[model samples]
Target: MKYLVIGGAGFLGSHLINSLDGEITIVDDLSTVKYFEKKPGINFIRQKIENFETNEKYDYVIDLAARPSPEDYINHPVETALSNSIGTYKALEIARKSDAIFFYTSSSEIYGHAEIIPTPETYWGKVNPNGIRSCYDESKRFSEALIMSYLRQYGLDVRIQRPFNVYGPKLREDGSYGRVISRFIYQALKGEDITIFGDGNQTRAFLYVSDWVEATKKMLGKGLKGTILNIGSDKEMKIIELANTILSMTKSESKIKFLPPREDDPPRRAADISKAKKILNWEPKVNIEEGLKITIEWFKGVLN
Candidate 1:
């Protein structure tokens, strides 16, 4: 099948492209990632998705383009907002015109400091509209609304997936924008102090990228039109525990250091994947330990 993957050079997008086997075209601005080796069956276009104009039709259009990390969003809020809002609109329009199945990769941050623990898709979410994170969070919420509107007005076949903290190979392992797992692994590999932004009490459910790709492929194959599902592992752990796990796995002398928390950082995040289980017959197979081992190996290679 032919596919259009916007932001296909980013962490999750790159993994998705690598996992797919058909004709695929990747449109990206290369904001976060600059260089990707060209491979057969994948066409790479180095352009912003908002400006991407294509009359060619595809069977699937996957929108994964956005500044997803909290630090990254706060730094480039305008770009983040535009990519999710305008870029999303452009992607949805492409899907509508092509009569293709559209898939949007939303975020767990949409459920900001959710009152519900393992947040379900039904939760309306408690988000600060004017907060630092609102750019990323609100944009995602707005994008979902846009998708639903198209589905209602134009009968567009669209699917939305809210992925919780996903980590594995190709995850940005640099600066403040890096994800928790990758950052911890990077510090441990470098024998530097592993920094925890809060009191190390915040919890997050981490899903390996491979498992996320598997579930995404299943959802695409199922053609679950107009469905919103959470794609994440149900296993939850504290930030301190995750740090300790990384230190143990890497056998590093890195100590855990707690710092002041960032603004609007959620205290806990877990996904209620019951909907995905019942609807797509999918569940994350790699546990935290196994996932970490693989990630640690990749980080080691990068560091060396």
Candidate 2:
């Protein structure tokens, strides 16, 4: 198998590359990665998506490259938006020409404020167009539009997976861009206070990296053909409860610090996985407790 990962050096791409049974090829700018390390079967080239020109054909093209950090968007909005939009356009072009299976990693952020609990695939999301995080969220939403357009017009095989709060190894925790998992876990390990951007009641489902990668593979293989799926765990946890869980799991002395609610953060986030389960026969096997153990181990190695 021949596979091409656009952001192959980043968190999700690195893990996915490790699991794929293929001659893996990677194109990425490892400038932002402070803790990135190379792994096996990966032919990596330090390159950006805009200048990434390759004649090599691939059987699969998985695009995990994008500026997914809120800090990036705030500091360098232009560059962030470019990486999200133009970068995706180039990768989809490659997938189209090669007739390869295209897998795009979308986010659960698109579902801004759910109209119902456990949002199904058919539910139209409620997003603020002019919000602060719109650069990241809207760019991803536009990327999805591009993929669907290609699939519809050119008959390309494209798979979309919207994963929620994925956390594990290779996370960027230099206080740059990441969800609560990496930063909170690091602080909890060090006995620092955990900061919540919104009220402590905002709920989210954190999927382990392993589950996310497996679901991506499955979706690439069998869930395409114009099927958009939400890949997330249904186990919801409050922001405060999540902090407490990390504190308990790591045996840390970190205290929860509440702050004013941030703009556009939904009160609760939970996915309706009936479509994913019925279609791909995929469900999260690892619970949060087990996932945290694995994640804490990784964080310990990083901190040490």
Candidate 3:
């Protein structure tokens, strides 16, 4: 099988590429990650997804392109928005023409400060269109709509997955672009203060990369077209608890520092993964402790 992965250098995209087996082609602008070295049966095209052009039809065309981190998106709002909107359109068009199965990696951010505790795919979501995070959130929502439209009008085979707080090895561990788990792990490992933006009561469900990849492959293998599923752990934990756990696990002397919350930061997030279980027969296997231990070990290597 031949596959096309856009943003193949980013955290989730790179992991997904490694998980797949086939002749794989990667398109990335290298804005967030370095271009990987050439390898057999793998081709890397260093370009923005919006500008990617090809006549080769693929069995799978996955779009994981976007400024996924809040700090990154807020800094490059236009790029983030366009990456999902126009870039997604380009990918969908390719899928439409080639009759390829298109997979869109949406986000749990579309749920905003969700009214539902464990937000289901059926929930319409309560999002602030003009909020700081809307660039990433609303654009993702738009991409979902675009994909559905194509599915409805042009009969494009499309699958959508909303990943909630996916973290593991290879996650960004630098600057403001890093996710909470990686950032906390990095700080704890380095004996720096683990900063908590809000009151530390905000909650999130973390899914390890391996678990996420496994579920994704299962979903793809099932060939469920025009389906939206949540890929994440239902095991929820508060931000403070996560930081404390990382500190304990790392045996670091780092102390937790509380700061004012950033604008539009969700108070809580957890995925109702029943749809994924029912449709794909998939659920996350790695528990939080095991996932964090593995992640902390990986970050130790990177930091050292």
Looking at model 1, the pairs that clash are none
Cα lDDT tens digits for candidate 2, 172-260: 77666755788789889888888887768889888888888888888878545888999998878898888888899888887888777
Query: What TM-score goes with each of the models?
Result: 0.98, 0.95, 0.97
What clash count goes with each model? 0, 0, 0
* RMSD score of candidate 2 (Å): 1.6
Question: What local distance difference test score does each model get?
Answer: 0.90, 0.83, 0.88
Residue 242 lDDT in candidate 2: 84
Question: lDDT tens digits, residues 151-212, model 3?
Answer: 99998889999999999888887886788998899889888899999889999999999999
**lDDT score for residue 39 of model 2:** 74
Tens digit of lDDT per residue, candidate 1, span 189-226?
89889999989989999999899999899889765888
Worst 10 residues of 2 by lDDT: 31-40
